[model samples]
Target: MAATLPQDIKLHTKSRTLELIYSDQEQFELTAEYLRVHSPSAEVRGHGIGNGVLQTGKQLVGIKGLEPAGNYALKIIFDDGHDSGLYTWEYLYDLCQEQENYWNRYLKALADAGETRHGNMIAKG
Candidate 1:
């Protein structure tokens, strides 16, 4: 089967979310914190099985910028200085489909590891 492509991509920095539209009329809005921690980079995913890193403290992270990685994926730069992940159309779709499950798992892992989301948002003081 052939892969589906995204018809449009919009990064709303103010809302810190990525909006993707596909030719099939499917749309998704993903948050920057979710994308950052779930990045498929070696830094997070590692080079082999069981090498994935546990990311913490990204509750308030925001997208700094986004670049197209050829015609297949998006290169997202997070405000926390992470810019290695390539978000492909298929992957993004999967994320949208399983967002709730993934988020629950992330939260559980953080709790099990005695960690917390150290978001980048500053307190209005």
Candidate 2:
């Protein structure tokens, strides 16, 4: 029994969420916007550590396509024309597990950059 393979995967387009059930019966609901902004692609995640791009204006981005990449990952195509990320099963699991910490960091980064999740800039004092 491997935790690397998803037992079931459902894409709820209307809600913009990806539901995953693992082999161990663990379940996770990952949002499209979360997947989009935190894409494993270098464009979003960066090719090196601490070089990730701060994605904004993706509050409404949708998942256009989901194609399997061998038995390791899935190739996600976003509605905004981003198709570079190869989201492996392990990566997805990590996203689900560390979602809270990661999201918090993202929000803090946005606020520090004076930008909102919608890409709007905030006025500084």
Candidate 3:
């Protein structure tokens, strides 16, 4: 079965979030940092299984714009110059459903790497 596509996609530049509104009254707001960190591009996802690169220093990143990629995905242009990923409808739906879990994992990974979302190294305590 095909994934359900959002009926509307809105980019809130001031808030730096992408809002997805579904016909079933479901809505999701994804932060630019969240989207950037979870980008499915080879730069973030890597060229193969595992070996994924960690994205840091994107706390204030914002979406510059978005372009539809055929009928399946969106090509997001970020202010930080990252416009390589194609965010498919299915992948986007998954991101929405797993937001909290994915966010938590990102935070943990950042801490483990002594990195801050603002692109700084965590000072040793």
lDDT of 2 by residue, 4-76 (tens): 6778988887887898888555888888889988999999878799888899878777787799999889998
For candidate 3, the 10 contiguous residues with the lowest summed lDDT are: 116-125
- Which stretch of 10 consecutive residues in model 2 shows the poorest summed lDDT? 116-125
User: What's the CA RMSD for each of the models?
Assistant: 2.7, 5.4, 4.8
Alpha-carbon lDDT, every model? 0.83, 0.84, 0.89
Estimate candidate 1's RMSD in Å.
2.7
Backbone atom clashes (below 3 Å) for every candidate? 1, 0, 1
- Model 1 — which ten-residue stretch has the worst lDDT? 116-125
Off by over 4 Å in 2: 23-25, 119-125
Local accuracy of candidate 1 as per-residue lDDT tens digits, 47-70: 999999999878778888889899
Name model 1 segments beyond 4 Å from true.
1-3, 23-25, 119-125
lDDT of 3 by residue, 1-125 (tens): 25469988999988989999986669999998899999999999999998899999988788889999999899998888899999999999999999999999999999999988985533221
Model 2, position 60, has a per-residue lDDT of 79
Best by lDDT: 3
By TM-score rank, best first, the candidates go: 3, 2, 1
Q: How many angstroms is residue 91 displaced in model 3 relative to the true structure, after the best TM-score fit?
A: 0.3
